[model samples]
Target: ASRCAKVRSSDVAVLELERPGSNARHRISEEIARAISEDKAEAIVLGCAGMADLAHSLSEEHGVPVLDGVVCAVTLAESLFKVGLKTSKIGGYAAPRGKRFAGMFAPLSPAG
Candidate 1:
């Protein structure tokens, strides 16, 4: 559970709330909504792996995308074996190149 991991001296802040059932769509949605509202998570993650199908609706209410465990597992797998990460380094990351630009966006920076 996220809360358990968070308290494990890992410096990870987490909150976990369990739902009554996964097969029951409405129940799961309610549980997730409650958690999102109460937990105030920086980014909400779906507790149930089976809720991948309702990501859009959840995001709409919470204003953030919900992540599923299955996708995470596969991503961890690929990163561990270096099968795709090293082969295609650009796929996972990129830096914003430096360039001069004149625009109102300059005031967006905190220092500006």
Candidate 2:
């Protein structure tokens, strides 16, 4: 939440839930309800990739858009692909210029 506050102006709320527990749907629904009523949240974004499956049903129940990060990422990637957008090879996504690989990774070292 603190990190988010530094980057974004909107309020950030963290709701922790058990990763493999059976009651996630219930707890998430309760949190969504609370966020809407208390925080005036217009939409909810699922924090965990594992929660992707619950977004649709939760949105239906809460009457708001519930977004899954994984889905959003894939959709953005697909849209970029469709529009022939490619990552710039001269910048951050560029091939390493002088990176070295040692031991079992020697074959991965860039060639001269």
lDDT of each: 0.54, 0.74
Candidate 1: where are CA atoms >4 Å away?
1-23, 83-112
Q: Give me candidate 2's TM-score against the actual structure.
A: 0.62
- Which whole-number lDDT from 0 to 100 does residue 54 have in model 2? 81
lDDT of 2: 0.74
User: Can you write out model 2's per-residue Cα lDDT over 1-112, one digit (the tens) per residue?
Assistant: 6322121112222333334445657877888888788777777877777677889999999999989999999999999999999889987888877977889989988854
Candidate 2 residues lying further than 4 Å off, grouped into runs, are 1-21, 90-112
TM-score, model 1 to reference:
0.44
Question: What TM-score would each prediction reach against the true structure?
Answer: 0.44, 0.62
- How far is 65's C-alpha from truth in model 1 (Å)? 2.6
Best by TM-score: 2
Number of backbone-clashing residue pairs for each candidate, in the order shown: 0, 0
Best by lDDT: 2
